[model samples]
Target: MFLAFGFVMMLAGFHAESDEEHKVAANTAMVLSGVYAVLILLVYFAQATAVRLDSLGDEALRIIDYKRLGLFFSYDLLGYGVMSLATFFIGLTINAKSRSDKWLKGLLMVHGAFFIGCFLTPMLGVFNSKQSGVDWIGTLILEVWCCYFLPICILSYLHFANKSNK
Candidate 1:
């Protein structure tokens, strides 16, 4: 998902009027997406390894350092926040003539808010206990807002791009 979105954003950057702006947006989107992908892969690997270790001995799995996992998750959340902000700005450049700019701006703001909450909630111990539902809530918001909402934004961009080409 990250790769696809990042690729689309990079391609959109090429439509910018100025070379400098295009370079900045393309580079920023690529680097941010790459970092986010790496972080996600690390989290997945850690979780999978921890699950496998559970079969060996309960203690072995229990010893898995969740602090590290949490840190990577936090980084992923932060990356999403940054990416949303960058995309919003880039949207401004690519969507200047589009009627959907207002709607896109609103979506970006909402996405930013959730990303912020994802970052802060865990730090405040809102998800401190494993039993706390905050973790699940935060995760759900991240998935829906990014995985779902972002695709909608991308589609909207594509719609406008098609219209403009005509």
Candidate 2:
């Protein structure tokens, strides 16, 4: 999924042809999106292969400490922050040739704002007190973000598909 997201961002970057400024913006977006992909892949690898959550007790595992918001969780959130920034930069490439493009660009930029919360929430110790509590709120927010993001992803694909058809 992260690879597909990165490729779409690269396509969006390459699609912008208005000016040198746009090209630079697109390049930046492409690089950031690539970074997002790599970061996420690492997060997945660390969780799935590097550490086995079932094998370790809550007190013993620092890597898979989802309950207390552990290392892998931080990496996951950080990867998402990178993804948000990539979206923001990719949003910059949108020239808004049509209403759909305009919507896509707007949603991407707004989604980028998620980086702030995703990056800072753990640092602020907001979830520290709830170590023993179920992180239903965080889970809900992520689901809501996915709901908001799916349309943007679909519109982005359509934008590129229409461009390719032409």
Candidate 3:
């Protein structure tokens, strides 16, 4: 989707602009972003198409239905975990020429920590959205995530704007 496209574009820009010393990190970020995009796209595609099928078997439904917490939900978490890795590597590539850039670098590096919960929580069954009364937990978690993510978007825009100015 658009999010994945924008993410890949941002990673590509970082990869292109990275200094020689940061080339490896940038490349790692770019590859991880690609994996994030692929995993996210696959989940979206499966949810949009297979979830509506009357002919889908019980086992198939168990895995792809977004209404139910299953494989697709796990894939969503895993994709974001991959994205966290991308952000961490991209953070390493930032040269931090200003206060804003420094904050951006710090946020990107700190955001990498989300990968820990994202990669492990699904296996722990703590995030299953439809498991009776815990539906609000998933919604609340995402809302909190958006709150954290909004600042990163603003700083990234500033970073790109300053780059163009320079």
Q: Give the runs in model 2 whose Cα sits over 4 Å from its true position.
A: 1-18, 51-54, 57-60, 129-134
Q: lDDT by residue for model 1 over 1-166, one digit each (tens)?
A: 4454554555354334425645665555456545555655565566677666656464444334343234545555665565564454444344434556556545544544555665576577554436644436555655676575765457555755766898
Residue 135 miss distance in model 1 (angstroms): 5.8
Residue runs of model 1 more than 4 Å from their true location after superposition = 1-26, 48-76, 130-135, 143-166
User: Which of the two, 2 or 3, has more lDDT?
Assistant: 3
Q: What are the lDDT scores of the predictions, listed in order?
A: 0.53, 0.72, 0.86
Task: Compose the digit string of candidate 2's lDDT tens values, residues 13-90.
Answer: 444653676777677777777777777787776667646645766654655655556766776777778778778877
Residue 161 local lDDT, model 2: 84
Highest-TM-score candidate? 3
Clashes of 2: 0
Between 1 and 3, whose lDDT is larger? 3
C-alpha TM-score for every candidate? 0.58, 0.82, 0.90
- What's every prediction's RMSD, in angstroms? 4.8, 2.8, 1.9
Instruction: Tell me the lDDT of candidate 2.
Output: 0.72
Provide the lDDT at 36 for model 2: 71
